[model samples]
Target: MKRFPGKTMGLLWASLLVCGGAAAAENFEQCKTRLFNQAVAQGVAKSVATEAFDSINYVERVIELDRSQPEFVTTFPSYYSKRVTDWRINKGRELLKQHQPLLTRLEDEYGIPKHYLLAFWGLETNFGSYKGKMPVLSSLATLACDKRRSRYFTGELMTALKLIEREKLSTDAMVGSWAGAMGHTQFMPSAYYRYATDGDNDGLANLWESIPDALTSAANFLNNLGWEPGFRWGREVVLPQNFDYRQSGYSNRQSVSQWRQAGLTRPGDKTLPDSEVSAYVVVPAGHQGPAFLAYPNFRTIMRWNNSEFYAIAVGKLADQIAGGKGLSASLPDLPAYSRDDIMQLQKTLNSKGFDVGKPDGILGPATRAGIRDYQIANDMVADGFPAKQIMQQLKVVQASETSPN
Candidate 1:
């Protein structure tokens, strides 16, 4: 899933005004009118566009959500814990058994394991207990007018319009997430248009109501994304006490043999299984945190949802669903950095010429890389994870009051 911006809703509302009087002055209905015309120009039938937009209202709540995804503030451990709870795990197991025949067929056809499919299904909508209730058309339309990511959401809105026409779905029935991701496996409009399938062979890819269709569509997506068969996403591993922290990250790919030679082992000090598969070490938290030896399939998971924490949670949850033990090491309770602190850290790094990109208060790859460079320069563990210590060291703050003991 895309990580949305995280700032005060007031700031987002103000951003519209800063674009000049025309945009700032436009009301919701005016933006809706323009979007409807755009839809018609883009090949949607005028009647279809009109009916879809006729009663659609701008969803202010959706805008608030789009500007505040949790990945920006929550640590990986916290995210993982909340997402991969026992309730979810048990529910996944029950659903795995309940949908075994259909899932098995999907697995055979698409080469994606049933557990992974179930994990995605569970995580996406909690096994369909709560597929979002917001009207998809209105949500997409509202975002299509929002300038933060207007182009992207505009395309999604068009795709959704096309999907309704092609699938013969009732316009009023098209309800989903605030971002317009729909069905049991929360697929975006483009993904739905491209990959949704009639797994039950009922002549309709009814993702919203059909478990078979939803699971099959999800499986088809992974299959198209180049999901490697017979490969686990990755493993939680034990690093040697003197292991080089600089070697951590998705960019540092190495063969299992090389990794073992460099003192990487499976949890409990077992040697990495002999294989030709190339993998990377990802230290999401830092040197003091649990490490993972992520494989190629991990990247495929990242394609499904770009966040490393999301991918890890899915992989681990799938493993547990398949009767494997969870992580061997406990996640450390790290210090929490507020949005202001992150923006200041990014500003400081940029000012020092580390190039963290514009300070949006999101700890993305560029910010992490900048932190790593700063850490390397200062003889600190270059794990790239932000901390109170790093902030103080860079003189971005005077003290480490938020440091976790």
Candidate 2:
């Protein structure tokens, strides 16, 4: 969950990379040879480097995944519903009670809450049910050889080799997602080297085989990521009917008192806490969807996975595992826009000189900004949400059309 940049959903398809077409590189043998030599140069013992290389193979599907782009961006409702399930919550609660003594100790030592740890544990591999089966060295080497992210992944591959060399771990024993994230927490090699903990005090930080190691390592990871000790990740809040949509984003930071004064209230119209902790408004699904007063801890959660949807899921799951209720607001049914429709919208926005960058059909920040600008210019709601009316007005779709896609 921590350093496989972009979406963590890559874990889902990472297994598909196990077998496929031949290497797309000019010479895969040469690629492996170079990687082996580079590993040796990076201080991995030659024997260990050779052993690692012997286990390495070209995972051709990783190349395709690396170069591919998402067509349709997933909505918050879709994402939240999938991860924050009743079963997951119940399981997490069961685990929390089962490990209460250990979790309480971790919270005391690391200043991280027990429920948040369980949230991370549940989200990143579902309490160790599956931590991927892709060969770590092969996948890292395959990605390192690719020109797109060669430099960064080369460093990661080097780190992985170093980990193998240091720990004397068998290459066959080292497996993870196609992106090379390992163990229950989906940590990259560097994270393992830096933050892996021996919570059970058995002397080794074995994330794959030890629950204590995995959970404690996760706590250390979050602690180092600047988790606010006592604060909740964030909470769903109600925006006033006349709340300005333009002020709704991470860029707009204000205190709880300030937001309370600006008409941000709790779900049941309860006033916000008078405490002066800083928070920002994140309308992840835009104005019509649930809004949250994302605290500093929310930013820390982003450091874990770097996705608003992921962070929201973690926070909400933690809340439920601690016996809290669900979100008060119902998610509005969004227009089922295809990749082509969004791509066309992006093109339209760019043509009008809104600078949404190249159209990739993903509703990234720039596209949201472009939509906001267009909406504002047209005297529309300017929520930056790419709502049905906005897309239709932009001619990305016809007003008479209803999508079943």
Candidate 3:
């Protein structure tokens, strides 16, 4: 009877797989036909649309990209070190010099500083050396069909079609990131629609071939995102002993006086006289690392990529392009552990009656909050950063609580 049941289950699984494959193929065909008809209705030649759609297949790479995945995630230090190193800095400086007039014009127009623009150039594509190796249409189509983020990817895919229709780009030339972000600055198709500008005035904002378009478009994006003219993003600062960890996160509004009252002080450089603008405090590595008082402009930078590390890396890289020194502080000292170790640590904490959120390997905010709760219960400093010492202590606590004496 058991063998009979196993065979039935195997047949059911095989049938389901076949059905799913057929549905996906059907969906792709429907999407392609709809797109071709729409293009024709909008005056695009039927032959052109047909030719473009003929070879486009649903690419599998887009849905598989999660940097936090086990094979992709890496240490923050290593990540930033490679991206904001001497080579990038030097290249940015050369580009800055080479394109001073255009940079000046962009700065004047958008009020976004030139360094920030060039920094994006360096970071987004390493000065346009490799602007991704994916087909934009296929990638978008695949991700749009993916169950995870279908809505968002489908919207972007439609936006890409609009770009092709407007003659802003040709189908054959729309290669980009597997996630459908294209050109030198990795602008998603929708972003290109909204913020892209023709700084070179060749009638189109061609970020693919024109240097002016990429830099100016980036500046325009920042400007539209609320960058204040003649104002700095944020200055590096030192937190006094016993800084409040709870109050630290990205901020768009905190008066300079308020921060100063809370013991945030910029070392060496005198605080520029701008006391009215709101700012938020950021301490990337808990309490032990260097801190900064991020202004509203900093939040604007964060809008480009909602990661503290990404924003700070861009800010720091911009500073490097502007002939500023490297970071004046270091990261909090913590023993680096792999994903498996962190998962085990989380499980141990959970078994010892401390709810450390899910025992997933990712060390996100909830996990940090749980660890902090555990630390406070055990009379340890609530730094939140995981380390060898904390993991060992957790083990000891778990064993003591679980031992059947």
Q: Which residue runs does candidate 1 get wrong by more than 4 Å?
A: 1-27, 41-43, 68-72, 350-355, 395-405
TM-score of each: 0.87, 0.90, 0.84
Whole-structure CA lDDT of model 1: 0.86
Please write out the lDDT profile of model 2 over residues 115-202, one tens digit for every residue: 9999998898988898999999889988888888899889999998888766657788798898999999999998999998888887
- Per-residue lDDT of 1-405 in model 1, one digit per residue for the tens? 755466766676787766644453367678887888888998999888888887587777888898875534788878888998889889889988999899889889999999999898888899999999999988988888888898999899999998878877787778888889998899999999999998888888888889888999999999999899889999999998887767877778989888988888998778998887999888887877789999999999999998899889999999999888888888888877777878888888887788999998898889999998988888887788887688777663323433463
- How does model 2 fare in lDDT? 0.86
Per-residue lDDT of 27 in model 3: 85
Candidate 3 lDDT for residue 208: 88
Clashes of 3: 4
Pairs of residues at least 3 apart in sequence or in different chains that clash in candidate 3: 253-278, 253-279, 254-278, 254-279
Residue 65 displacement in candidate 1 (angstroms) = 3.0
Q: For residues 221-263, write the lDDT of model 3, one tens digit per residue.
A: 9888888887777877887677756566542346888887777
User: How many angstroms is residue 95 displaced in model 1 relative to the true structure, after the best TM-score fit?
Assistant: 0.8
